[model samples]
Structure formats: C-alpha cells, structure tokens
Target: MEIVFTVLILLLAVAASGVAARLAPFKLPLPLFQIGLGAVLALPLFGLRISFDPELFLLLFIPPLLFSDGWRIPKREFFRLSKPILALALGLVLFTVVGVGYFIHWMIPVISLPAAFALAAVLSPTDAVAVSSIVGKGRLPTTLQHVLEGEALMNDASGLVAFKFAIGAVLSGTFSLMDASLSFVLIAIGGIVVGLAVAWSFGLVRRKIIEWAGDEPGVQVVLLLLIPFAAYIFAEHFGLSGILSAVAAGMLMPYVETAGAESAATRMQGRSILMMLEFVFNGMSFLLLGLQLPGIVGLAHIDAQMAGNVPVWHLFAYIAAITAALIAMRFFWVWFNLRLKSFSSALRGRRSKQRALDVRLISITSLSGVRGAITLAAVMSIPLAMPNGSAFPARDLLIFLATGVILCSLLSGSFFLPWLLKGLQLDGEHQRQRAEEMRARARVSEAAVRGIENAHDKLSTQLDEADQALLTEVSGSLLATYRMRMDAESDSEETHRVANRFKQFERELRLEALRAERQELHRLRAQQEINDETFMSLINQIDMAETWLLGSLSSSN
Candidate 1:
C-alpha cells in the first residue's frame, strides 16, 4: 500500500510540475520543481516517507538520465565545441579539485588531504540537469547555451575520471602528477574506443534487422536503451571512463543507423516511453535524497552533542562551501576568458571589453548552479567503508552535503532567477527569443520540404494552417519542376506521379479554354456573322473535341 501510494503521489507531482512549467513566470524546469516539492512535502512530518539505499540509487538513476541526455545532444555539436568543452570539462574541473582540495585541508586540519581531495572530486562536475533547469529555458544566446551544455556533458566524463584517480590515490596513500595525466589520457582514449565499438555493433544489428523485417516495437527500443549501461560497465571493467562510454555511446547512436523513421509516427510512438523512464527515475532519485535527510540529521545531532562546540552540521557547510567554490570559479573563469576573447576582438576598453564579453550572462549562469537528481544519486552511492577499514572520507557527510547543495541551489536559483534577470537589465530586445522560435518552426517546414523533394515523397506530419499550407503548395510546385527536370534523365515512379499531376491540371485548363470559345461562337451568331456563324461554330466544335481527347488521354494514362 505504501509503495502504491508513493507512486501515485509521484505521478501527481509530475503532472503538477507540467502545469507549473507553463504557468510560472520564470522557466523553472519540471524536474527542478519536482525536487523542490519533495523537499517541501517531507517537512510536513506526517506527509510522506520512503526508504533509500546506495544500491537503489545506483541501480535506478544514472544510466537512463545520462543516456537520454547524451542521445539528445548531437555528435557533431559535441565535436564542434570540443575546445570549449575541454576547457570547461577538463581544465575547470581540475582547477576546482586542486583549489577546493587545498582549501578544505587548510580550513580543517583534522581532515586528511585525501579526504579533502575526495570532497573536491565529488563536487567537481557541475550537473547538466541543474544547469539546464536553472539557466537553459528560453534564455541565453545560442553560442553560450551550446558552450554551457557541452561543458555540462563532457565535464561528467572528465570529473568522473578525475574522481576515480582521486579515489585510487586515497586508497594507495600516494598521488602522482604523471600518473594522473597518464590515467586521464588512457581512460578517455580507451572509453572512446570501447563506446564507439559498442555503438557501431548495435548500429550494424539495427541495420540488418531493419532491412530484413522493418519497424519494431518498444522491445527493440529497450535494446537501444541498455547500450549506455552496457558501455559504461564494460569500459569501467577495463579501467576506462564509464561515464564517457555511456555518453559516447548515446552521442554516437542516432548518427550511425536506426530502425525508426525520423518522422512523426516514430516520435509519437517513442515519446511516451522516453518521457516515462526519465520522469520515474528522476522522481525516485530525488525522493531517495529526501528520505536520507531524516537518517543523516539524526546522526549529526548525536555527533554534535559529543565533546564538540556546536556539532556544526559540517555537511551543510561543505555543500555551501563547494557550491560557492563552483559558482565563484565559473564567474572568474568566464570573466578571465572574456578578457582573453576581447584581445582578439580588441579595440574595446576593459568595461567595454567586459560589456562586450557579456557581463550579465556570465553572472547569471554562474549563480544558476543548481545541483539536482544526478548529483544526489552519485553522492548517495559513495561507499560507507574504505578498503583499509576506515570510513569512506566523510561518506555520510558527503551525501548530506551533496543533497543540501542540490536542494539549496535548485530552490534558491529557480525562485530568484527571474529577479536576477530583471535586475541585470538583460530584459530588452526579445528579438532573439522570437527569432529562435520562428527558426524552430522554419526547421520543421524545411524538413517537410525535404521529404517532398525526395523520390519517396514520405512525410510525417498532417499539414494545415496558413504557413504550412503555403509550404505544402510551394513544395508540390517545386517537386513538379524537379520531376520534370529528372524526366529527361530517367523515368521513376516519383517523377511519373508528378508528371501525371501536371498533365491532369493542364488538360483541365484546355477544356476551360474550349468552353469559352464555344460561348464566343454563340455570341457571333446572335450578332449575324457569316450566315448564322456556322463556320465559327464548326471551329469551336473542333477545339472542344481536341480538349476532350487530351483530358481523356490524361485520365486513362
């Protein structure tokens, strides 16, 4: 009964979130709101309850969310933005790890350096879900949006690789710069190789099956679904980047081959499945985070009363500290890079340079650091025990801290982001916003046109409305011309259909012309021309006969 009830509530929560998404002034993403609501509901004391564990977290959350996100981001975009992606993913993550690790050790001598580094690694990668939730909706310029998204995606790979190295260093009680460099290079290369192999193999199977059989149901989709986890696990077994493997596999899959149409039919069928998995897993992970609060707070209370001054919920402190560290680091990096960029786009002063660099965009995105479900899931899976029998460096503490940051960042960012936008005076010139939406619509129209342009003449949508109707007419005319052009070269079914249509319309016009000539002959007879217009009548009859012959010829053929 409890399980059923919880599921019902979560379903309600998702439904409510969908409504809130449209109604809210600020574009608070549905996933972010679901998490915020879960936290709020948990405060009621008697409102809701659930149990959570590391296994549940690992088994349920990461793969699907990561896979879905990876699939949606195109491979070309990923490769195109590789430079900025590397800067944000590898360079920025390393900078955060070293800077935060040193700070934590300095702030609390009681914590070991390894423990501090562990803390740094855990907090290194910014959550893509969070960034998308907080900053990505109907905001930012296109280039920056791409940069941030690419950063979020690739950083998971870089951060996870760094994390494994940090963990290994902790276990072995030694760290080496050379080893870290070699490990990152190898893991990245190896993961790409493994992931590409996995993606290519699946692509091959998909091609054969699609060629032999045709369209598949959701089961084949499921096989595609597991690619991420399979790639991740296999890569990790060989000491490579599991996160990268998952990301790479997803990123590569669509471009390779598929059994489904890039049409409305497939999208309509697959949309529900994709959305359901994402929604259910997202809610479960956040709910688990909320569930842990009770257990963690209880333990911290006891720890506080022990010979300590105030038991400083050090977890919350760490969450805030690291969250701050991330926020500060991003802004600093953005500012510095903008200056560097200004040199190339030089002849602008420093303020002009900064303004030219986009002051508000840098600030808003920096503050929009909303940790979310993925971060919670990863933190929840931290091992409770180390290899040597000591506790995992602040394991419970890290979980608590990560959860706090996720909640804090999301709630505060979502609720306040509107005000920040307004305050920055980045509010004017919504031309870009309108233009983007128009471009999106144009893309659909263009795709439809392309379908008509092809020999297959296959399209996914039912066309209507003024814009679409106009597009359909234009495409029909263009296709007719194209087929006419092709007729001189070869005879194809597509060209024949178009040619038939053209002939049919032409014959109708000829019949109309002949009817007009017959009426003219009657008018001539009434006016007394050449003895009752007999000669003109005969001419009109001949023209009418020719029209019928041509019209009939078109119909029969």
Candidate 2:
C-alpha cells in the first residue's frame, strides 16, 4: 500500500507539474517546476521519501524515452548531421572521460582515478530532453537541434558503457586498454544487431497477428510499447549495451511503420499514448532527481563530517569546477570539429562564412550539455564496499558532486542558452524545410488525383449509367479536394488564399458533423438504446474522424 501510494503521489506530481509550468507567469522550464514539486514533497512536513534503485530506474524509464526520441527524430537530418553528432557523441564522450576524469582526480585526491572516471563517464551523457524543455520548440536552429538529439541518443550508450568499465576497474583494481576497446566494439555491435533483430522479428509477428486477428488499435499500441523494453532486456541478457539496444529499436521502428498496414485509429492512438508516456516518464525522472537531492545532500554532510571535516562548500566548488571543466572540454572539442570541417571545405574550394555564428553555436552546444537522471542513476549505483571489504572511497561525495553538477548544468543551461541564441537567424533552414514540405505535398496530391481519376475511369466503363454517375460524383469530390490542397501550395497569393478558405470551410462542416454524431451516440447510450460496447465503438470512430479532421486543419494552416 505504501509503495502504491508513493507511485500515485508521483503521478499526481507529474500531472501537477505540467499544469504549474503552464500556469506560472514566468516561462520557467517544465523540468524546474517538476523538480520543485518533488522537493516540496520531500520536505520534512510531507516526509515523502522513496528508496532509489538505480538499476530499476534505468530499466523502467530510460528505454522508452530514448526509443521515442529515436522513433521521432528526423532521419534525413540525423544522417546529414551524422559526422558532427558522432564527433560529439563518440569522440567527445571519450575525451571528457579522460580530460574530466583527470581533472576530478587532481582536484580531489580522495577519489581514485577509476572512481573519478566513473563520475566523468556518467556526466558525459547530456539530457537533450531537458534541453528541449529548457528551450521550447523551434527556438534553436534545426540543424543544431538535430545534432543535439542525435548526440544524446548515441552518447547515452557510450557514456554508460564507459561508466560500466570504470566501475569494473574500480572493483577489480585492474585496467586493460586493449580488452576494454575490444569489449566496447563487441558490446556496441552486438547491441545494435540484437535491437535490429528484435524489432524486425516483432514487426513480423505483429503483421501476422494483424492478419490473423484484424487490426485492433489497443493490441497494436501495447505491442508497440513493448519493443524498447524487449530490445533492452534481450541485449542486456547477452551482456550488451541495453541503452544502445533501446535506441536501435526505436530507430528501426520507423521502417516497421512504413508497411502501411496500420489503420488510422492505430496510428492516432499510438501517438497519443506514446506522447503521454513520454511526458509522464520524463516528469517522473526529474521529480525523482528532486526527491533524491535532499537525502543525498544530508548524507553527504554527515559523511563529510565523519571522513575529514571537509566543508559542504568544498563539495559545491568541486561541482562547479567539474561542470566548468565539462563545458570547457565540450567547447574546445566542438570548436576543433568546426575548424576541421572548415578546413576540409576550404580544401574543396568551398570557403566558409559565418565563423562568428559557429562560435555562438559552439558556446550554445557546450552550455546545452545539461546532465539529468542518467547521471544520478549511474552515480548512485556505485557499490558500497570494495573487494577489500572497506567502504568505497568517497562514495557519498561522488553522489553529492554528481547531484550538484546536475543542478549547476541545468541552471547554466536555463540561464545561458536563451541569451546565447538571442537574435540568431535560422530562418534560412526553416524556409528550406517549409519549401521542401510544400513540394512534397504538391507532388503527393497530384499523384493521388491521378489515382482517383484512373479508378473512376475503370469503374465507369464497368458500371451501368446511374451507378457510373454516382462513381463519377464521388471521384470528382475527392479530385476537387486534392486540387484545392495543391492550389493552396501555389505561388500565387490569390490562389492560395482561395484554396485555404475552401479547405477551412470543408473542415468546419466535417467537424460539425462529427460533433453531431458524437452527441447522438451519447444520447443513444443514455437512453439505453445502445449497449455500452456499441456506444464506445461508435464514439471512438467519431473521435478518430474528428482527430483526423482537426489534425489536417492544423497542418494545412
């Protein structure tokens, strides 16, 4: 009952955080509000405390969120920006592990090199979701945002893998560069292979199920939700990188969905359900962070007093130093990559401009490396005892430092990112994307119009006169709608306006019809004219129609 109540309270807090963030007069980040709510719940008055389990948290929360990001990220842009993203995700993670590892060790001699490396490794994975929350949609350049998303996806695996090795070294008191390198390769490749295989197998099974049982949205959505967890577990069972597996599964999901066997209801409901899960899970992550902060700090203070009478302020200083080191290392790396790209372009006789913009972007990227729940989970997983049956060196201080860094990074990102991005003109990329979408829409509409005409002509030849007339009328209506949408994409202002008006009027009428249908269904149910199941089925159809209608209206506008 206590455990159940805690979960219910956390869910409520998650819901309340969303509303509070919206209702707040100031534009504070949603994560801040959630963390604040969590802290309030943890206060002495409320005394809400739940035991933190790193492994459980990672298993429960990380996979789906990462999978969703992989499924939703723009594949084209991700591939285009793959070079920079790999540089940041792979190269920079290792770089930070070494650079920041040594820095932490030097700054605090109490922490062994392996322990310091563990801390730095965990810190290497930035929370792009938190970054997105800090800077609202479309605020950053599209390319930059894509790079960040891609980096976040890949680095979570890389960083955690490094953390694993670091922890192993700490426990075993031995490190081998060659062995670790080979293991990393095998782990990464195996995880990727496992993920792809799992997703593909699941896709095949789902297709068979649909063929056998028909397309039920509820079943399909539940199956969709299981992909990441299955992949993660399967990969981990083989001693591979579960994080990578989750990401790989998510990336493969787009291709799985390309079969076009799913109904409109499945797609709509799946999207809604996935979005709700992302929100709740993300909120829960930050709330957990806030919930752990007070206990971590209090315990650290007690440990500090017992260990060496180290000041609490020294821990804060260490966090600040480590945070600065991370940002500095990241900035330098991004600058070097940008310079290398520029040099390559120059060699190809394509001299670059916008050097100043590159600097600003580098700064933005550095500050955007805000740590979140992953770091907390990783650091908290540090074992209490070593092989010698002694307490792990500076374990409490490590957690304290990690928690402090998470807060610092969040604060810096929240404060600095907006200022750095001020007046940055990314309109060129936005306009290019808009133009490409318009072209695609126009081409697809044209193809659809042609298909409808072909079907009508074939049917007309086979039908009697009255039936042929009905077919012609139905086909003409579809063709007219397609033509209007194509016209809305035209260069001419008058044609676009007229076509948009037609679309708007059509959408309004359809929406009104859907509302009437909904009301009639409710009336039928209230009067017991229809059974509950029948009413629900009919109501769902109406809701799906309205959802599609409104979605199209919003997209068209």
Q: Could you tell me every candidate's TM-score relative to the true structure?
A: 0.70, 0.95
After best superposition, candidate 1 residue 525: deviation in angstroms?
A: 62
Q: Find the 10 residues in a row with the least total lDDT in model 2.
A: 300-309
- Candidate 2 structure quality by residue, lDDT tens digits, 1-557: 99999999999999999999999998778888888898889999999998999999999999999889989999988998899899999999999999999998888877889999999999999999899999888898887888999999999999999999999999999999999999999999999999989889888888988899999988999999999999999999999999999998899888977288888778888889889999999999999989987788778776566436788777777789999999999999999887787888889998787464467878988998989878888888989999999988888888888888988999889999988888987747778888998999999999999999888888888999999889988998899999999998999999999998988899999999999999988898999999999998988888878888987877665
Model 1 pairs whose backbones collide: none
Error of 1 at 437 (Å): 10
Q: Lowest lDDT 10-mer window, candidate 1?
A: 302-311
lDDT of 1 by residue, 1-557 (tens): 88898878877766776677779896665666665566656665656776666545554466666767777764665678777677777887888778878877775554567766766766766665555555555555555556666777677777666766777777788889897898789999898888878888887876677668765755456667677778877887897877777777877877775644433334444555766787677765655565556666666654333313345566456557766777788778767766776675555543332355566777776766556655655566666677888876656555555666666676666666666666444333345544454455446545654667663333314544665667667777876554443442233678657665665676677777767877777677777774655755577456647755675564344
